[model samples]
Target: MGNYQSGDNTIQGERLSRREAVFDKMDDDSFALFYAGRRKYSSGESLFPFAVNKDFYYLTGIEQEGSSLLLSKRGGECREFLFIDPYEESKRRFYGKKLSIDEAKRLTGIPNVLLSTYLTSRLDRLLRQGLDGEEPVKKGYFDYSPELKIGPELDVKTFVNSLKVVYPDLHDLDARPLVMPLRKCKSDSEVEEIKKAAGYAKEGLLSAYSVLRPGAYLYDLGLFYEHAANSASSCSGLCHLTHIASGEEACYRDPFPGQKQAKEGEIVLLDVGAKSGQYGASICRSVPVSGRYTPHQALIYKIVLNCLRAMENLARPLISLKRINEFALDYLACECLREGLLPSKEAIYSIAYPNMVCELGLDCPEDYGELTLEEGDVIALYPGLYLSGEATAIKLKDVYLVTERGCRRLSDADIEIEDIERRFALQSK
Candidate 1:
């Protein structure tokens, strides 16, 4: 069901199976629509490079503009259709030729491949009248979010409204509910893609670390990290901006690196995110600029590091993300109290002492914290500390694969204090 091809005309493998699984959850008269999105224009025909919609990519494995995937289950029969932009001589000369119908079929395993021109009419026809002996689609799911407020060519809100005005009985629903569950657990191929990104990320981390000197600036490290990451990636220009923060900004995750010079006693951050096959690996490291951490710096670093380790141990299946976050915060508070940094453990949660423990900025604090960890679930963990009085912060982040026993940290970077010091020492020589 996962990795098998059917006939000579179709390659019914990974993406096909993913679509089939989603179809199983859907009602018999429902259709799911996913847009690959278009190459956005910034100013005066200056187009932004296309990034395929994650859900659309997940289902079709096709990355292109003016493309969409439509999956419908009706009358006990599942149908899949892929729409791609038609080839044009001008487009071919400027950018590249669009995906051929045969190529689209081979890549997505969707036997019915159509051009973008036919998409609207095809959808209208399907939603209006019964087709191929199946009842008309009564309900529809879209990769849509009102909060996003984005206007792709097929804007879900606008399209839903227009279609509803014509067919008032058509029911519109969010595709995330049907599709997100399938994406929560990383498939083997997806895991491999993330691991590949992690490999690039580790190299980027070390590359940036190798150049860390007292005179170095955050901008310098960020440039080196981006260079190393993109060089290590399978695709060109795959690595985006490397987020590097210093002092209190470490907890804030500043993406724009500036000429903030390193100080002898200050710590600098190298928050690197690299990608492979659209899967990203996020790794954050805050290190001492002087090679060895100061006594007070090491103290805070140790607290945050210990909290991260404890969180890793607490990442077994069936545990809630919020519970894991709470455990880490509680552990940090206890350690802070032990160090006399906090007057009491309760101070950690005090509104006045908001910076006592750093906020989970990278972790998207409120996003999936309510969900319980499950085997094969891939989640990000950011354990951090912010000592407002000390005017410094420390945070550690890594992606984890939740397993039956415990979680496994995805990045293979050497991030321990001793390792950081040793690498800086060797690089200095």
Candidate 2:
């Protein structure tokens, strides 16, 4: 299977292969249904920019709202169907023409294309036929996640409930278990997209470094980082929130940019990301506003860096996240004891202490809840520190691709303490 390419927009061939793989995994008499997400209202008269459902985009490569995909495996034969919003004059006038049926077919490589308005009738007919046929559909697979709240109009829960009322014998299956594994392991093309995003993130960090001086406001620094990423060719002018913090603010679990001004002899922390081809790269760095780190600050910075390196070394495929966390906790404890920061190993787990390591990902929320340790899953680490009873907080984040052999760092920005000091000194001169 080949990819669909048109101007700046193209879907990789691997996505098509992924869909095929899903089909091959499904039972012979089952069907899967996926929906493109609906646009949400930002305010009274404005709507947030439409973001396609990650799963739907993964399978169909169609990013438009009001779109759906149906894949059926019956009698040892598999077929694909695509449903999309039809051409409407008023909508076209307001938002330009949506993707045409012909273009959708070309983009998605689905042979059957129909207006989304026909979806209800089509599904009803198919389910009825299956009920009357010899090899009826044994299960209906739907994309459902309890964590995500869908609006009334686009609620899959209601649809599934109605389907049960009409066809009580049909079994419903959650598609997440089958699809999440495909998403976790990045393909070559997906890795390239992530690298592009990383490049943009590097540019943003460099831009921030240039203007990182005393009296600089955190908000302006965040804007500078965002502007650099948004201006990059690979970027689609969209990204996650940029976090910029100084001193005590940097030590917080999740810090947001504000009007706080940096002062002399203080370190500034930044956590930013750029999105390209719908993939994102997360990067974090810490810089000294005064162009030099205090001896104490430098020591703490090196500790966090060491922890990051240790985490990188442990990030191999089939390694459990729990193991990684245990390693980090033990490593941090040892370093703390050596540095005289901790009295004993028992104090390592104390929340009041410094040298904490947290997990970071593309979809990780800013206000992440308690970390759960899963034995069968891999982990990503972002290093940061908070010096107890002091006004110092430093954070550094980078994206890593967990490979079969080892982990590969995607965001390879210059984060060395000596390198940062050298750059600042050169700029000062």
- The TM-scores, one per candidate, come to 0.90, 0.88
The candidate maximizing TM-score is: 1
Model 2 Cα shift for residue 408 (angstroms) = 2.4
- What is the alpha-carbon lDDT of model 2 when measured against the actual structure? 0.73
Please give the TM-score that candidate 1 achieves against the real structure: 0.90
Q: Give the alpha carbon lDDT tens digit for every residue of 262-377 in model 1.
A: 77787877767788877777777888888898988898888888888888888888887767767877888899899888888888753122221111111222133256777877
lDDT of 2 by residue, 123-238 (tens): 76567775235445658888885432245254787778878998887789987655665665566666677778878988888888888899988888888888898888344654
Q: List the residue pairs that clash in candidate 1.
A: none
Write down the worst ten-residue block by lDDT for model 2.
359-368
Full-model lDDT for every candidate = 0.73, 0.73
Q: What would the C-alpha RMSD of candidate 1 be, to one decimal place?
A: 3.8
